[model samples]
Target chain A: AQRVTQPEKLLSVFKGAPVELKCNYSYSGSPELFWYVQYSRQRLQLLLRHISRESIKGFTADLNKGETSFHLKKPFAQEEDSAMYYCAPPDSWGKLQFGAGTQVVVTP
Target chain B: EAGVTQSPTHLIKTRGQQATLRCSPISGHTSVYWYQQALGLGLQFLLWYDEGEERNRGNFPPRFSGRQFPNYSSELNVNALELEDSTLYLCASSLGVGSNQPQHFGDGTRLSIL
Candidate 1:
């Protein structure tokens, strides 16, 4: 079975500190990974995808095929970056399997 | 252009009653997906519809069924609803059935089953 795992339910970091939200997946095919974010009082939106190799809102994720991981990382966390992040793996048919999501809180 | 839209932002119903949720995909999107997001649980795929056909479905009971209309609008029907069915139902739309396009979501409908 294909599954995406987000280990942390909630992660807290001080402003200007580094932040890393872990994500791992189990799949047999050439997996396509994505990161989706939902800010408070806002709808869920796409953040970035591994295939595009692009970073959005100062956050970037690299697909580690050997480790089967696509962890989201940021060098300097900002207060505005606090939000719920979800790691998703879209199947060949475009059905997205999402992780439980990790809530990040950046303290000032 | 407007993004994906879902009707009935919030609903309250008793157990055993039926509930219907509607979704309207983006103007040109041919694929619509339904998901259930229970509190503290990840989003679970419910159904996938494309071009007025049921393309795929998740591990759900027969009572959880839905259909797509000719215009690509979709409806999810849950019969004999259970307390566990209370969840935030989300609808998403994509250009087609592939990874080339990202799925855009609408503000979900929060269903409360008593």
Candidate 2:
């Protein structure tokens, strides 16, 4: 069974500190990984994808197939970056499965 | 263009009652996917409809069903709702053209079962 695992339920970091949210996926085929974020009182939106290789909101994720991981990273966390981040399943024809999200709280 | 839209942002129902949630995909999107976002469950794909047909479905009971119309609008019906059925039901839409087009989401409908 294909699954995406977000090991951290809540990750706390001080403002201006670096943040990394870990994600691991189990899939046999070439996987297309994505990071989705939901800010408070807002709809869930796509942050970035492995294929695009573009960084959004100062966050970037690299797909490491050998390690079966696609970890989201931000060099400097901002207070506004506090939000719920969800990692999606491997690319498929239809909707992608999601892992239990990780909530990041940036404190002063 | 407007994003995916869901109706009745908040709903309250009792046990044994049925709940119907509606979703309108983006103007050109041909695929609609329904997901249940419950506490600690993340997001569970419920159903996927494309070209007015049920293409894929998650592991859910028969009581959970839905269909897509010619306009690509979709609805999810939860029958005999239980307390555990309380969740945020989200609807997302994708172009269904090329692969890897990320699904755009709407602010989900929050269903509260008592």
Candidate 3:
């Protein structure tokens, strides 16, 4: 079975500081990973996907096959970046197996 | 184009009653997925539908069932609802059934069972 693990349930950081949300997965095959974000009172939305290799809102995640990790990172965190971040792996039918999520609190 | 849309932004039900949730996929999207986001439980995959057929299901019981329509819309039905069933039901859409594309989610219907 494919499983995703997000070690942190909550992460607090000061504005302008670097942020990294750890995520690890167990999958036998080459897995596609994604970082999804949910702002207060907003729907869950895609932040970035490993396949796309693109950064959004200063956030980027590298798929490290050796570590089986796809940790989300930002050079400098912003106050508005506070939100719930979920790490998910897609199944064969596109169903997502999501982690418990990390609540990022960026303090100004 | 409009993103995925789910009806009944909020729903209230009683124990032993049935609850039905609806979803309309984005334009040109043929695949729909359902997920349950309960308080403190995070997100749990419920079902996956593609081309008007049930492609996959989670470990949930048979009471948790759903179907995809020809137009690519879908409905999730939960029979004999329990208090534990109260949670946010989210519907997502994608281009097809695979890991290649990321699914887009709706705001979700918040269901509260009393």
Candidate 4:
């Protein structure tokens, strides 16, 4: 079984402050990690994936096997960045396990 | 192309009643996935369908079942509904099964069991 954990239920940061949303997972095999974001009144969508190894909208997440973590990070936060963030395993295997999600509230 | 779509944006049912939800995958996509977002449970995989076949299912019971059609559309049926069964059922689609392609989600069908 695959499980994902997002320790924080709500995360708040002021404008221009660096932010990080923590995520951890447990899987026996090589894990496929992804970060999805849901903006206000918008459907959920991919923010950035570990395999892609690229930043999206100033957000990036690194998959660490040793620590079993894939924490999302942003150099500077903006008010528009407020949304729900989910860490998940691959949807292909039907596990698609997602963390409880972190509600990010970026304040100006 | 249009993103994934789900029918019956909202539904209401009573205990022991059954509910059916539908989904249409994106053009050129052949995979559809069902997930449930309860009040506190977060998002959970319910089932996966690809090419008109049941490729996989989550830890749900037999009461939660679904099938796929040749057009890549899908249906999810929940029987013996309980109050806890009320939730937002989301449908997602990708190119196919076992790929790295990100799943595109629908707005979701909100089911309320009384």
Candidate 5:
């Protein structure tokens, strides 16, 4: 069985501090993971994908195959970064298996 | 291009009533995905459609059904709605299965079951 777990339900951080959201998955094959963000009253949007290995909005996530984790990280948390983040891993048919999601709060 | 779009921003229904949600994928996208986002429970995959065919379905009851049109648009139908069915229904589109493209989402439809 495949499952995604996000250990933290809520994370509060001060502006300019670093923020990290942990995501661990259990899958049989090579996994393709993604980070999606949903802002207040806004639609969910793709933040970054492990395949791309790129950063978006000062956020980046690296897929660690050995540890089976894809942790999203940001050097400096901004007020705008406060939102709900979901880690998604796709099944064979391309259906996304989303984590429980982590709510990040960056206070100024 | 316009992003994936879903209709009926808000819908209210009584128990046992059926609800149908619509979605129009972005142009050139041939895959559509449906998800349910309930309070506390993050996004849950409901269905996946590609090229007007049902590719896969999530761990949902048969009462939760949907179909995709030739134009790549899709509709999700939930029968015998219950209070637990009150949630945000999200629609997303992608280039196609195995394309490794990021799915684009739309402003979800809020469904309230009383």
Candidate 6:
């Protein structure tokens, strides 16, 4: 079965420190992955997608098919970056298979 | 434009009772998806509807049922709710089937079953 795994449940970091949240998936097709974030008291929103290869809010994720991973990275964490991040890969029918989100806490 | 919207921010019910949650998709969106956000289960896809038809569903019991209307608004009815059913039910919307559009989520309805 196709599945997305976010190994970290919580990541603690100080302001200006680099942060990386790991995600691995098991799927059989040309994978298209996306990252979604939910900040405190806010609705969930799309952060970035692998296909676009674009950075948003200083975060970028690269799809490594060989490793079956699409890890989110931020060179310098910010206080506003503290939020819940989920790595999702759409299923064959386009339903997002979300991982067990990782909560990132960037303190000042 | 307004994003996806869900009704009744919070609901409290007892076991064996039924709970009905509503979701209104974004204007022009034709697909609505329901997910269960529990404490540890992350987000489990519950159902997907498009054009007033049930397109897909997750590994949930029959008690977890829902439908979509012509306007693309959706209703999720949880019958015979259990204690474990306490969760944040989230509703999301996207473009029609086959359209590669990201889903927009609502604030979610927090269902608490005693």
Candidate 1 TM-score over all chains jointly: 0.95
- Tell me candidate 5's fraction of native contacts, as a decimal between 0 and 1: 0.64
Q: i-RMS, every candidate?
A: 1.5, 2.2, 1.6, 2.5, 1.7, 1.8
User: Which candidate order results from sorting by DockQ in descending order?
Assistant: 3, 1, 5, 6, 2, 4
Query: What is chain B's TM-score across the candidates, in the order shown?
Result: 0.96, 0.96, 0.97, 0.96, 0.97, 0.97
Candidate 1 residues lying further than 4 Å off, grouped into runs, are none
In order, candidate lDDTs are 0.89, 0.88, 0.89, 0.85, 0.90, 0.90
* Candidate with the larger lDDT of 1 and 3: 3
By TM-score, the best candidate is: 3
Q: Put down candidate 2 lDDT per residue, A51-74, tens digits, no spaces.
A: 877557989997888888989999
What would the per-residue lDDT of candidate 4 be over residues B15-96, giving only the tens digit for each residue? 9999999999899989898999876667888998888989888889899999998888999999999998888999999888
Least well predicted 10-residue stretch by lDDT in candidate 6 chain B: B94-103
Q: Higher-lDDT candidate among 2 and 6? A: 6
What tens-digit string does per-residue lDDT give for candidate 3 at B1-114? 899999999999999999999999999999999999986778998999999999989889999999999999999999999998989999999998677778899999999999
**How far is B66's C-alpha from truth in model 6 (Å)?**
0.3
Better of 1 and 4 by lDDT: 1
| Better candidate number, 1 or 5, judged by TM-score | 5
Candidate 4 chain B lowest-lDDT run of ten: B95-104
Taking all chains together, each candidate's TM-score versus the true structure is: 0.95, 0.94, 0.96, 0.92, 0.95, 0.95
Local error of candidate 2 at B6, Å? 0.4
For model 5, residues A28-86, the per-residue Cα lDDT tens digits are 36456789999999999989887767557978887788888889999999999999999
Q: Evaluate candidate 1 and give its CAPRI docking class based on DockQ.
A: medium
Clashing pairs in 1: none
